[model samples]
Structure formats: structure tokens, C-alpha cells
Target: MGKTLALVVFAAALLSAQAPAKKTTAETPEARAARIHKQAIVVDTHIDTTMMLGRDGWDFMVRHQPESGENHVDLPRMREGGLDAAFFSIYMPGTVTGPEAVKRALILIDHVRRLTEQHPNEIALATTAAEVRAANKAGRIAALMGMEGGHMIDDSLAVLREYQRLGVRYLTLSHSVNTNWSDSSGDKPAHNGLTDFGKDVVRELNRLGVMVDISHVSDKTFWDAIETSKAPLVASHSSMRAISGHPRNMTDDMVRALGGKGGVVMINYSVGFLSNERYEAQQKNVPSAELPRVSWEKIVDHIDHAVKLVGPTHVGLGSDFDGTTVPDGMEDVSKLPKITAALLAKGYSEQDVKNILGENILRLLEQVEGVGRQLRAAASKSD
Candidate 1:
């Protein structure tokens, strides 16, 4: 009887081992990522879709594919990517300056404003952080404008004021070439950083409630902007130099200093900015099509490095979409969900992820606006 009982027990154990395992009831990484991403107010601080406007007559209403030429962010892809807001850049090449720069900037702003009005159901023009939240709440993507070069302002405070009135929220001090007042990373150091007039520009922007974007500026200019600006500055579309070793990318010390002062560095999605090897290929005059692709995971790596250096509050997204080549797998705005998913896998908490996505920049905007209010009030009193 004992041997028979033992045989029966052994048979049951064998059956239990052979049976399929029960599925877990816990939430999956993908599902959790989606949930958190959907719940977050996603904002991309830089995109060059406006540049595509003059060239190919880019329409915000149309859904553009990844394979399309320099057409990255659009309304449909933004919705698919859960992007609640984006800053459409008013771009002008370094060669295009003076009246032409001013004219082009005005035209681009007009285009974005008109497009937003034309697609009222899908988009809303936003200037303030409050307006951005309101637009997202109403289930519409917020269309924000940023000037890509200080030269576009025509060296006039009145023009800058008009730009602010027309909803230009940030002004990148320089582009690939140095402006009269500010030095650019891509050019020979002309002003040695920022001229006296450049510092004045920073001050005026603070008074006008426009963010001072230090993306393409030289290291000296970056430091000067940080020092002169009353409000916290933004590196609208820059990555980390420690990771990619590009001069266009910020150093770890720059990141730390920027974060220490309440400023944020929005990571650019350019593969060359995220990977040194790819950047080397770019320097060798390799064509964009032939430029070796970097893993999209490098995007998250940049975010991770920034977060680790300055905590999540100082890091945000500023995909240089339509302006530069991105890493593989992040073909267009549609693939942004992968970033949130990867962050989750890297053990970022939901709130941290949300902060990095948009909240941090929103907070920065609100603070900048508050400072503007104070400055204006003081000016009124002085008068």
C-alpha cells in the first residue's frame, strides 16, 4: 500500500511540473508605460516642422511618414506619440540675415498661427504654460513658437516685443553661426561668448517672458546667458557631451550648473548628438542617408545620464525633429511612445517620467512668466 501511495504522489508531481505556468496578474511594462505616458502632458520643446513649411508646403493636417524628406512631426504623428505640445521653430540659416531673417521669421510665425487657427479642432495656439495645459485639457495639441536665432530679431527690442506678443516663447541666441552679439558652437568665437548687447538681449527676453534658449551657443555664451538672464534658461535641443562628445552637446558641468539654477536641458534626438561614432561619420562628410544609424536606446541613455546628473526635473524632450537626423527606431514623432516605454524599463517612476516629459518645462515657463510680471510691475512703478 505504501509503494502504491508513493507512486501516485510521484505521478502527481510529474503532472504538476508538466502543466503550463499561470500568467502573472501584475501590470506589464508596456501597459504601464502607455498608462503613464497617456496620463502625462507630453511636450516637445523644439521641432523644425516650420522649416518644412516654406520648402514642401508642409501641412500640419496631413499625416507624414518617416520616410518622407525632412518631415518629422505632424498632427497625426503627434497624437499617436501622445505629444500634447510642441515648439515649432522659426528657422533661418546663418547666411540669411538682416531684413530677410526678420521677414522669414515673421512669415513662419504667421504660418504657424494661421495653421493653428485653420485646424482649430486639432490644434490651439498657446503662449503661456497655463494656455498649454488648457489646450491639452481640451484634447487639442498646443502649437507654440520659438525663434531659432537671435539674428531673427533684427537687433531691436521693439521687434522682440512684437515677437513676444505674437507668441514667440523662446529665442535661441545663435544657430550654426555666430550672431553679432552671441557666439555659436559651430562657428569661430566672434563675441567670445555674448557681447554687452547679447546680455541685454537676455535681460529683455526675461522682461518679455520669452525663454532664453542656449542650444547652439558656444560654452562661453551658454555661461553668459545663464549669468545675465533673470529667468531660468533652456537648452532647447541639446544632448550631453559626456555621452556623444560633440561640442554642440552640453558638458556634465554645464548640465549641473544649469540644473542648479532651475534651468532645464531638453535632450535633442539627433543621432549625431547622442552618439560620437555617428557624429564622427557626420564630420567625415557622410551623407545623411549613409550616416551610420545609432540605436534609439541612446536617446533614453541621454535622458538617463541627465537625470542621474541633475535629477529628472532638469531633463526634458526637445527632439530636433525635421531639423536633424534621429536615431534608428525613432523615425518620427510616432515612435515617441518607445521612449516612455524604455524609461519605464529603466526603472523611472511614473511621476519622474511625467516631469521629464513636460511638467518641468511647464514649471520653468510659469516661473519665467512670473518674473516678467514682476519686472513689468517694477517698470510701471518707476514710471
Candidate 2:
């Protein structure tokens, strides 16, 4: 009986050894997202970080929680969130005009440039798509500049040229109000779309390699600018109107047109733009006291809708951080990874996620730059 038992044990051991080891269970969605997020070159095209810096005298090198301070972005949080690049906005309120507008834009621009100069090892100012990649490879956050309103130019193409010379790569045609040349979504229509001068501004922006941003423009202005622009456009910080039903959000037709033109619509995280229900609830309250809660899932729904309207190549994250109240889970810039996880859970392919994260904007930047070079060469030949 002992011999028989020994033989059975040996047989069992041999069978176990011969059998292939059981494969490990598939990685959890969260784990998959984290891995993918780390590998991707995430970029936020619109952030009002400079506005906060100018207001609170906050240190860009130090990380501060939103509850502790009004600031939402800093070096440590960016690193923690794996954000590779960001466009620090030079935002001049629509009310500020004439020399005052120009002065405010200059001050904000200087502040952003100073941040990069102060943190050479952590961040570098990038003017081109290649420079952004280089900054990423160097393990630094690529800093880019975007002017939030065309009013900053004050009807002077010379001022626009100076802005480009100062490293402003994108210009949102209007802010919360209409400018002399362009109409804003937030204000009463003035130009009805874009004045002839508005079309001139688009041409000059294309020639100078500056992206024409239509985020705050009226529907007529959005269509007009895209039609006039020689290069791809960028709705730097807007969401889907189909979902949120806000004027601040782009309609499905606008998104489709933008995609056809090779432009991108970077979804905004502002609670008002993420959901109409939440926005209406907040507006109904006296003094806008309490806001209806919105989740990260709602933000993802906007992204998914944009992808469906226009392929994944025309969608990206703008965050609008520090400029507005974000959704519940996305209280600050550090919560960006949650977006990646959410997109993956929603069945987006790895490539689609990468495009939505940063690749799409990079391609747009390259194409815009190429058009600028061609226009410049033609002008020089004519001269």
C-alpha cells in the first residue's frame, strides 16, 4: 500500500510539472489605464494657470491643493499626473480694451515666460511640435503660450505679429465678449460673424503659424473663421453642445466641420460646459449658491461624442484648469489620469486614447507650421 501511494504522488507531481502554468488573469482596467497614461504624451491645450499666478503670487514650482488655494496647476502636480505639455493662457478679459488690453496681455505673457526661465530643469518653452517632443524626451513639461482674446491685438496686425514674435502660438478670437472684428458666444452679436478685418486676422495667423482658436466665438464666427483660415483651426477649450446644451459648447455640425478641416476640439472640464442640468441648476440658485454635481463620466461622454462626430484624431483635453470649476472627480490637474482610465473603460482603443491625449494636437501644430512656412516663402519671393 505504501508503494502504491508513492507511485500516485509521483504521477501527480509529474502531471503538474508537465502541464503549462496557468496564465495570469487579465490586467484590471485601472492598471491598464495607468500603464497607458504613463506611456502617452498627454497635453492640455488650454490652462489659465498664468492668470492665477499673476493674481495670487503663487509659486509654479510648488504644488497647492485647490481647497488650500485658488491655484490648480504646478510642477509637482503636473509630474504626478504625467502631463507632458500645457498652453499657459494670456487671458485678457473682454472688458479690457485699447492699450489696457495690450498691456494686460504683455504682462501675462511675461509671467509665463518667466516661469519657464525660472524652472529650466523642470519646464521648457516650446514653439513648435518638434520642440514639444524634445522637451518631453528631456523629462520636462513643455510650456506653450496662447492669447485668449483677439482684443489683445487691438485691431493692429502689427500687434498680432508682435504677439507671434513673443511666442504666442494660438489666438482665441474672442473671450467672454465680442471684439471689434469677431463675435463671441457669450455676448450679443456685433459683427454677425467676422468682419472683413476678421478674415484678414485669420490669414495673418495662418501666415505667422499661429493657430486660430474658435472656442469662445459665436456659431457664425466659428464657421466664418474656419472657412477663411488657410490652416487647421483649434477650438482650444470647448465641449459638445449636443450633450451640455450650452452656447459655450460646440454643436455637432461645428464639430463635424472642424474635423473635416483637420482641426481639433479640446474638451473643456468646466461644470457649466459638461452638463446642462448642472449649469441650469447653478444659474437658478440665488447668487448661484450651490452647483449641481457632475462626474468624470460626464466629461468622458463629451469626448466620446466628439470622437463619434469627428474621428478620434480631432479630439483632445483642454481642461480649462484654474479658469472654471471642474467636474467632481477632476477638482485639480492631478486628477487627469482618471480621464485616461475612464476613456479606456469606455472602450477606446489605445491608439485612440493617445490621439485624444496629445498626438492630434501635435499633428495640427505641424500642419499649421508647414502652412506658415509656405506662405512666408511665397511672400519673400514676391518681395
Give the Cα error of residue 143 in candidate 2, in Å.
Answer: 0.6
Residues 1-383, model 2: lDDT tens digits: 99999999999999999999999999888889999998899999999988866766567888888787567788889999899999999996889999999998999999888888888998899999999999999999999999999999999999999999999999999998999999999999999999999999999999999999999999999999989998999999999999888898999999999999999999999988998998777667735555667897888999999999989999999999988888778878888998898888888999999999999999999999999999999999999
What TM value does model 2 have? 0.93
Which TM-score value belongs to model 1? 0.92
lDDT of each: 0.91, 0.92
Clashing pairs in 2: none
Candidate 1 residues lying further than 4 Å off, grouped into runs, are: 1-24, 55-57, 286-290
Steric overlap count per candidate: 0, 0
Q: In TM-score terms, which candidate is top?
A: 2
In candidate 1, which residue pairs get closer than 3 Å at backbone N, Cα or C atoms, i.e. clash?
Answer: none
* Tens digits of lDDT, candidate 1, 1-383: 99999999999999999999998899988889999999999999999898666656667778977885647888888989999999999997977888888888899998899888788988999999999999999999999999998988888888999999999999999999999999999999988999999999999999988999999999999999888988998999999999888899999999998998899999999888999999898789998778777989999999999999999999999999988877779899999989999998888889999999999999999999999999999999999
Q: Where does the lowest 10-residue lDDT sum fall in candidate 1?
A: 51-60
